[model samples]
Target: MRLAVVASHVIQYQDPFYRRLAAHPDIELTVLFCSAEGAKTYHDVGMGTTLRWDLELLQGYDHRFLRNFGWGEGFFRLVNPGLVPTLVRGNFDAVLFMTGWAWLSAWIGFAACRVARIPIFLYGDSSYVPDEKSVRAKLRAAVMRALFGMTSAFMISGKLNGDYYKHYRADPRRFFPLPWAIDNERFVEGSAFAPGERDAMRERYGIAHDELAVIYSGKLIERKDPMTLLRALARMTHPAIAVFLGDGALRADLERYASHGLPASEPPSFPVSQEAGRPGGSAKSRAAFVGFVNQTDLPKHYAMGDAFVLPSHFDPRATVVNEAMACGLPIVITDRCGPSADIVRHGENGYVFAPGDDAALATHLDALARDAEMRARMAQRSREIIATWSYAEGVDGVAAALKSIAGGEQT
Candidate 1:
């Protein structure tokens, strides 16, 4: 079977899934990315991650970009729908759309596949909540209702996400929970961390050998609630340092609030990572704003922490939580994180706090910080849980689904 995957951004991270699909001798895959000149105008983060376009990754498959095609976003769509025939000429047996963020791409791709009578599958973790936009946006959704209704199947991440599609009037029979992501072997290999490497990372980050460290990694955004974490630390008494990973618009505010001990904590025993590196010896910032840790270096970063904590205000699903768990780092995540439900085993593996519950979040933080034995046990359990779910299993599940669709399985 020939499958054409449509996306809007650069898919450098999807190397594993694409490689798996490419390796299938029975399946020929074509990845269609949106043009970068086209991407500059697209403002959706979800759309960018889904499309994985413009920027190319060195891979074995034939991936192409359709820049001339006008998307409703970035560039206003034109009436010239001739691109439909061009995509159809690829003779794809199935069309898998990566997301709905780009209405032009999803809508046009769906239309083109329908013109060719090819089976279509939509893949994403989005819920069907109205954006409260203008009347034209509402009409666009109405058109999507008609088009997506014809989907052969869907690859969603959770029951909540599945219900989102059902609310859109999609066929329940076609709704399937196929979670996004599998550990890239590259990440897994990075997980083969040597004790010396961990020690080196700790030294490089200037974290004391015995400091109760809780690391928060990811883009520093309002949704991530780095400030709330600071507030939570304000309620705690443990002498823990928060290693803030990733950069975003809130850096200046976060850096200013990160004075002395972390939120929910007593007093800090040591200086902040940056302060320690500095001469004045006053970086006592709880939120050490170490921005944008590289993807390849994440394992080393996670290894530097005694535990992981992400107090996102409410992320649909913080994949970093999964990455932390995969790295065997016990986590203190909020209920807002999707992976918390599956990975966290309450007191067994880690603690979960309600979003923005500074007091409650402080309690969990103290539990992990004060009880060293429990922290180690939880970290061990994190790795064990990750072992049960391998990238190979995720790939097999995807391949089986594709094969089932080919075999005329009922929706």
Candidate 2:
């Protein structure tokens, strides 16, 4: 089978999945990128940093960079006219579009594939539950419904992602199960840190062995609501550490909250200070504001955490959750995250709370922190869950999609 993957750029997470797909003996894969955004050092608006991914994204995969007509990742900005000609020349059995109609290039590729009568498999992280319900939202939903109908098949990223297409009235048989995932082998193997190395990382953060480290890894942007974790940690009665592994515009405020509790004038979000039985205080727990950690170094950082938390206002699919699970850390994430609906079994592998529900978040955090046995059990369960959601599953979905489509030319 010859497969062509259309994407915006070289994402650090997706690169490994692409490599896994390319390595399949029965398949030949070629990735057509609209730009080289992540290939070179660039400014990331969310993370508030300028850096290139440390990993080699192009190796172990066949790929090409198309001529980009615009500058950034905007719907219209990612226009790539060269895709039409490239598709014609590549003679690919099918096109795997990694995006919806968010980019002009997606529409262009759709048109080209439709004319050539080649099946197009659509894959994305969009969930059924949207953040807003407005006039514009309705219009976008209508557009997506049409987009979903036109695609030959859907590569379901998660339960919520599958729900999205179903809500759009997409055919049920067209769904291919490919859970949102990470390179589990790398994280599982790489995160096996030497006891001394783990201790050194904790020492660097001033996190005593007695303190439970609640790790938060991602951009510290408002959408991710990094402060919720801070506020939750502040409410903890026992000694715990909030370890932020990424940086963003919210860094300074997070640092400030680490030093001082939620501002008094700001009207407390969590009833930590005035709680009935619990010892009241102003951000009693400490925090380690470790700046942006790269791809290769993430496993070690993940290994140091007692538990992982993602307090996002909304995330289509939080890949960091997958990475943390692969590293054998239990999860505590917001319900708004797509992975929360699928990977995170409430009170099983980890817990799930509503976005901004600091009380619930704090309560869950406290439960994990207070019990060493529970944390270890949940951590083991996390590894078990992640084992099923790996790059191999992603490839299986692609191969299934390829085989289902007409003229797929499977070996």
Candidate 3:
């Protein structure tokens, strides 16, 4: 089967899965990237820095970048005039749209595919969270029902996302669970450090052997809520090390909160490193702010930590949670995260607290710190759970959808 994938950009997490799908013997995949903004050096407002992905995104895939008439960043800004003509002439048996909202290119592709009588597949990560009750939201949902009716199949990220599609009147039989997965091999390889190597790496990062190291990665922005983690850590009396990876606009504020009791007007010591035996220093001083670590180097950082925390105010589906799970670290995520239900087995693999609850986050951290055996048990469960949510499983879902479509059974 010849398949065409239309996406706004090549994301770090999705790129690997696309490559895997391209490698299949029965499927010939062509990815249409609307913008090369992420491939080139672009300033990410979330990370608060310019980033060029270290990994090769287009290496092993049959792909092309559509001509982008410059508007600005994000999906709504993307204007590709050539998208419809390209899809109409590409002779693809099926077309998969990464997202249908906020992109003119995606809408055009959908229309062109329908006109050509080609099967339309949708892969989206949208969840049924922050339940909107406004009239605008209801009107949008009604419109979404019409749009989703044009598709042959819906490839969802998780159960929550499946329910979101169902909420828009998508056929349950046509809904396939193409789970949100990461490069598990890359993360597992990164986590497999020698005993002495793990100790040395932790020591270099100011994390002692006895202290529980709690690590938080992703953009240090307010929505990600890294400050909540810091505040929670500050109020804790437990002996643990707080590590913040990545950079953003909230850096100064987080650093101030980490060092002092309040957010103050002072330049933060970039990449602060504190030793174990400092004169008149407490465990709180062990908090380190390590700036952005690239994709290849993130595994070792995960290895150094006893647990991973993502205190996001709202996240559609955080793929970093999958990465941390592959590294065998128990997660502590907010309930607002879409993958929390699928990835986190509340109090089993990790704890899921309500968003913006600093005291609850602190309590979980303290409990994990006090018990070594529980951490080991949860870490084992994490690896086991993440093993099933792999790219291979995603391939199976795509194949099943293709088979169902070929059989003329679009329910």
Candidate 4:
């Protein structure tokens, strides 16, 4: 089967999946990027820095970069009028869109495919959440419902993401499991280390042998709620330290909070006030803010930590959670994360707390930090769970979806 994929740009996390799909013997795959954004150094507003992925994203895949004609960023920046002719020339049996209909390029591609009578599969990780009772929300819901109607099949990212389609009244039979996964083997290999190697990595990050190092890897932005992890760590009486592996707008505030312990009496807020904390220094360093780690070096960071934490206020599916699991670290994330529903089994692989509940987060951390046996058991379970959520499984699901569509079974 000849399949064409339309995506916003080449991403470090997504490159491996594309390569795996392209390597399939029965399928001919081509990825069409709307922009050459991550292929070179660019300013990332979320990380608040100019950076490029260290790994080459274009290798081992049949791909093309469409010429973009729009301005600004995100949905607005990706206006590629050249996609229509490119899709026409490819003459793919089916077109798979890696995103929704929020951008001009997607609508244009959808129109071209519709006119050509080609099956269109929508694949993304947008979960169903209650929207505000506003005019904008209503309009967006209507637009998404209309878009769902045009889709021939839905490549479901996870349970929550599948609910998004169900919420739009999509036929259940049209849903196919295209798990949001990483190159698990690469992560597992990169994370494997000898006793001395692990110790050296910990020493580089100033993570003491006795302290329970919690790894939080992502943009230190408001949505990620790094403050919750900071607050939870501060209140913990256990000997623990936080190893942050990304940068963002909240870096300065987090640094100050980490260096100076907060007053226990301060009222809890969405973003715990940076002003309320006094200059009382911590017993030792509470956290380390290692900024913006690249794709190749992530496993080493994951190796040095005992537990992985993602305290996002809202995240559809944080693939970093998957990466951490692949590295054999127990997870501690908020329910707002999409993977919490399926990948993370509470009390089995890790624990899940309500978003903004630092008290609950602190309790879970303390439990994992204090109990070596529990951590070991949970760590093993994490590896077992993530081992099933792999690129191979995703490719199989895609091929089955194609066959079903071709046989007039999935409509």
Scored by lDDT, the top model is 4
lDDT tens per residue, model 4, 1-411:
899999988787788899889999988999999988899999888988899888867888899888889787657777988888888777788899995676889999998887777789998888955674899988877877887887888898899988888988787788888999998998999998876998777666666667789999999999999999999987787877788999999999998887665433222222222222223432346577788888888998997899999999999979999999999999999999999988999999999999999999999999998999999999999999999998888898899889877854433
Query: Stretches of candidate 3 above 4 Å error?
Result: 129-133, 262-286, 407-411
Q: Worst 10-residue stretch by lDDT in candidate 1?
A: 46-55
Best of the two (2, 3) by TM-score: 3
Candidate 2, residues 130-226, lDDT tens digits: the string is: 6448999899778878777777789999888888789888987888977777778889998997758897766666566777788999999999998
In candidate 2, where is summed lDDT lowest over 10 consecutive residues? 270-279
Clashing pairs in 3: none
lDDT of each: 0.67, 0.82, 0.81, 0.85
Q: Write the per-residue lDDT of candidate 3 for residues 75-162, one digit (tens) a residue.
A: 5577777888888898787888885566777777777877777889988878863455999877877778888887788888898898
* Candidate 1 lDDT, 128-207, residue by residue in tens: 36574899878867866876677887766655567667767888766554565556345556767665877666655656
| Candidates' RMSD to native | 4.7, 5.7, 3.8, 5.1
| Candidate 3 global CA lDDT score | 0.81
- The parts of candidate 1 lying over 4 Å away from their true place are 36-56, 68-83, 127-145, 260-283, 388-394, 407-411
Give candidate 2 misplaced runs (Cα > 4 Å): 131-136, 262-285, 408-411
Q: What is the TM-score of each candidate against the true structure?
A: 0.82, 0.91, 0.92, 0.92
Candidate 2 TM-score to native: 0.91
